[model samples]
Target: MGEKESEKLLFWEHMRTPIAPQHPTLPKLLVLLILFVSLTYLVYTLKLVSTSRACKDAPFSKTIIAVNATASAAAVLRRGSRETNPEDRTDLRHLVFGIAASAKLWDQRKSYIKLWYRARDMRGVVWLDEKVKSEENNSDTLPPVRISGDTARFKYTNRQGHRSAIRISRIVSETLRLGMKDVRWFVMGDDDTVFVTENLIRVLRKYDHNELYYIGSLSESHLQNIFFSYNMAYGGGGFAISYPLAKALQKMQDRCIQRYPALYGSDDRMQACMAELGVPLTKEIGFHQYDVYGNLFGLLASHPVTPLVSLHHLDVVEPIFPNVTQVEALQRLTIPMKLDSAGLMQQSICYDKSKSWTVSVSWGFAVEIFRGVFSPREMEMPSRTFLNWYRRADYTAYAFNTRPVSRNPCQKPFVFYFSKAKYNSTMQQIVSEYERHRVPHPDCRWKMANPAAFDKVEVYKKPDPHLWDRVSSEEKLLQSEEVKGERDHGDRCGYV
Candidate 1:
């Protein structure tokens, strides 16, 4: 029991074990070191797991849904931006429509409106003059409007060509006063104007109602556009106002109308009012004002960079889709067709990677990429099929800087071929053509430039430097004539 005896006992135990007694301090240090290292490793592992989760949470932002996808198409085409999902959209309930029509056209508007509007959750009111009011019997969607001025005329006065457009202020003022408390946007368009609701919803989400925003695109008609204020949101093609801006307009609308007596049209008047409020026109590409007269074959065939929103003046123009009628185009628009963003935007021209079929808006210019993956055989007399690589179109030889690949019209793929010159076709017609053909895959690359760019754009023969190069236009048959030889051409030619 003495200290010497205890020491002697410890030595004997160590000797028996054949191991030195570990330092008491060393044991504590070793335990602490192990705990520290384990904690550091665990913290590092947790950090890596958090980063991976964040990437998974976001597939794509809803705001740039189609845009990013379309950009992806550009990348894939330019070997850049690739357009993905066909039917990505936000809430339609937040958007409301306002269709301005003549009394005579009220009945015509009702049919399509009734057909398409209900399914998409669209809420709208029809504005008609007193004459139409007298003519209309149903009176359900057509609200009774009371204009401040008497004797509304197509010609507001001899000096003004405003037609009934002079009534725009009152119409918008009334629409806001109608007490639509639910929706965030108030979209304005003519009765003849047709819209793609899914695209419309996506477009509306890009803006904020908290700001005073007026969104639309310019009229496609160069003359009409020049005659009118370039800053205006051409009413016929369709335009939208955020809830806050509409409320802002309502406050001074009466006075604003009184101030703009000399304004020639409703759009200009609206622009003037917006200017007073310091609101600028926010231009979007999807809206179309068919101010031009003629077939929109080339324009629709090329397809646009953005989603198709509205198309106006359906009566004057032929259907832009390859081979379809107006009535059929109207029907296809109401429901969801198995199409992607580019297809849904109503492009007349598209290339199916799956089918390799390239259809154009021209009368009968539909061609398929008939190259088989396994065979890679050339047919002296081929049926329908295109080269699979074209199923993934490489570069759209645009007429810009000839900079290999870019959606930038001025910068690259300098062989601008698609026409930006005009658009007369309704968005529906383009959709109809694609639904039947479904030409291009959503991810396939497309080159849209001035149609003039295609002047010498024939795919060059093999063993020729002109392959996909700019060549003389003299020997080449035009796209119109090519339609006639499409079947024969498919047998002979490998290029689009």
Candidate 2:
């Protein structure tokens, strides 16, 4: 038995193939390890490259690079903060006004400039076509006078337009060349334009002076806007140019003027330049071109919900108040403007439920009492009291919607002009008085009580300096409710 087992084992061992040493597998494992390492490195390197590209495409990439290069991170943050700081707001000191007046009209128009211009607090120049006579005793009260640079080189091809449009347009470029420091805005206006300085600052502050902006308004006349441009900022109404925009304009404005010889006015030429720079008009309804004739009552009484930044064509319109000189009327208006310019001309509608009467109070201006309820929507539309700029044009030619002066005796509003306003210290409110402006109306047998019964309309309001801040939400609510035809009876009723 032992011999047979030993022989079989020996035969099987001899027949079986000999196995290779385990050492060969070491090289294969080494190759796999090398591949794994290379793959890991490639994956890590690709992730780094992707991160770098992401950083490069980021908006604050420059800020990050600046932070990395020896500049303290706090310093970089501070620079960003400085640009956005609320305290660094646009102010009068940052503005340089360019008032366009001819030496011929300087005597008459300079008085208008004196009404708003504060030489002590403002930096500006009165650009006259020629040197004004030295009869002005107190030159200190006015902006420093400067004769405009000659524009004889510029060609004006418009047969109907004044060639002085070329001169006026260059006032901005000339003002820029004066090398005034820290100027952020250049506001241009005709001598007749009366600015509400505080409100102008409020508007200018909303924009970034470092960026480009062209701020003003269109003319009230549809014909004027269509004939000139819907994109133009009317010069008479006054337009503000951001410092950056003005600088860009200074570079190309003369060339721009040359290109537009056929343009009718200074504003159109300016608009052509703005178009080249790809800027559009940023309209502010408060700046009134007032391209109309007659009393400003209709427009002022229902001013759009914004600060009244300026009024142009003052000489053309009747004095704002009855029986007062234009200058005196403005002085009276400024009283309320000083108390609360934000609330000035802001319309508020209320119901006198006891009398079943509707009262629409245009704070700081006028009040109108109607015998029956009138929709705020109707009251918001300005009454056609003023004539269109083109005497031949009718109400249909207006840029805005206007309601005809009511011919219905029953529907006529008893108007009251603002008489005086005083602060009631104990109540912490402003008590404004509006005396009834007596006008004869045809008698009607309508059952509604007459608005003429009331002699004075008294409005008590708490001076809201921040009224505009709340206007957006309140306007939205008003619009929503008006649309639903379910506006609450007490909504926007009183001072509260």
Off by over 4 Å in 1: 1-90, 131-163, 321-325, 333-342, 346-496
Expressed as tens digits, the lDDT of each residue in 1-496 for candidate 1 is 9999999999989878866667589889999999999999999999999876855655657535656656655544531111133233235666667777776666666554543455335567667665543535444433343333442433344274645766654566777777876767888887778777666766765555667889998865444556666688888888999888888888987677677667787888888889999999999877877554445433443335466777777776665433566655556543322232223423222232443333233211222221121121121111211111112222231111111222333221112122111112443232212112332223223443222212222221112112222212432446335534544344433232
Candidate 2 regions exceeding 4 Å error are 1-87, 135-137, 470-487, 490-496
lDDT of 1 at 286: 79
The TM-score values for the models, in the order shown, are 0.52, 0.80
The per-model lDDT (C-alpha) reads 0.53, 0.85
Q: What is the per-residue lDDT of model 2 for residues 97-213, given as tens digits with 9 covering 90 to 100? A: 999999998888877887888888999988988987875664667888888888999999999999999999988899999999999999999999999898898787666788899
